[model samples]
Target chain A: GAGVSQSPSNKVTEKGKDVELRCDPISGHTALYWYRQSLGQGLEFLIYFQGNSAPDKSGLPSDRFSAERTGGSVSTLTIQRTQQEDSAVYLCASSAPGSNQPQHFGDGTRLSIL
Target chain B: ELKVEQNPLFLSMQEGKNYTIYCNYSTTSDRLYWYRQDPGKSLESLFVLLSNGAVKQEGRLMASLDTKARLSTLHITAAVHDLSATYFCAATQRAGGTSYGKLTFGQGTILTVHP
Candidate 1:
């Protein structure tokens, strides 16, 4: 893809249900990131992936949150036993191989837990 | 830990007025990025400042970075109604390895330009 792509542009689920958000990064982009934006709040980093492995998962809010990237192209963020507080916009971003490269963001998946 | 703060959480100005949004960070950073987001839309990258005195401008918007003071500023010149949106400043730390490319973002400034 020419830019980062995210699936399930909007998802609304009942509390305690699980949800999965997907991201397809730009072709050949070696660095991928996940971020969460709550209503009217700043973005919070969730995880960072370099290639097929994640070097930093420190930002994951809880054990219920897990993410994985395959083939260094697509990634998935899964929230297990979702709570109402999990309602937010899940954004995916991809950058070129360097740390200084600007990240290109996806449209994001707006998750609403009811 | 890296922390970023943006001031003037909300700005309402006339179409021709000028304003500046300020961003301050608590620690040294490798780079600073400015992004704009319209309501219910994704973020759009505006500028990337890599050095202490770097400056970049596009159209009516200009961004500058001052690493010595851990600050960055986005200045709007003769603002227009089309420029109404939320602006965010993000900083990436100098740490390499797994922490690379991780951004710490400010609370963002919401700008509204009325005619």
Candidate 2:
């Protein structure tokens, strides 16, 4: 089976521009999550979706960041007015519908703000 | 709020030696997870500890969790060059009906194994 897939493995954009990162979860995975990794911040959870509805969004850094999942399989994270601080690797993960199931991660999209 | 921390943020070990990475959480968690990531790569799930005494081993790596102490350990036995990577430990707290699968990750430990 194919693992989680992410598009635009690398994206370089000017500050204040908007960028959208996409994620394709594994087949039959109902739980999806977004995470960010940076040099200063090791790894941080951004949001979590359960069956198309996001139940947790507390991890989002600011109002400019938003994510949505459709059909419970694909998710997109959009960052508006990107800042130099927002430059990092955006990782998406998915897992089966279970309490303690481990999440499988995608290659991640590296976002760089120039 | 949940906080997870890992010690020895940087480790350099010799091949064939043994070492352990420690993870501690600030709150009670439903599960503990270990992940490995290579340079310019995403995380790879290593182990999931569900119980206080849960211990799992794969190849030269072993993981154990002590829920009572809110601690988890990833031990490398006879470290090899291939084990060089960043290791992360995450804890998830159960909320209401669904877990939501939100992970609180610790600062990763960068491990380097050399001959």
* lDDT digits (tens) for residues B1-115 of candidate 2: 8999999899999999999999999998859999999998899999999988999999999999998899999999999999999999999988558664688999999999999
- lDDT tens string, model 1, B1-115? 9999999999998999999999999998859999999999999999989899999999999999999999999999999999999999999975465346588999999999999
Compared with the true structure, what per-residue lDDT tens digits does model 2 show for residues A31-105?
999999998888899999988988889899999999999887899999999999999999999999778789999
Clashing pairs in 1: none
* Candidate 1 residue runs with Cα over 4 Å from true position: B95-99
Please report how far candidate 1 places residue A45 from its true position, in Å.
0.5
Clashing pairs in 2: none
Question: Against the true structure, whose DockQ is highest?
Answer: 2
Task: Give the CA lDDT, 0 to 100, for residue B5 in model 2.
Answer: 97
Error of 2 at B53 (Å): 0.3
Q: Which 10 consecutive positions of candidate 1 chain B have the poorest summed lDDT? A: B93-102
Best by TM-score: 2
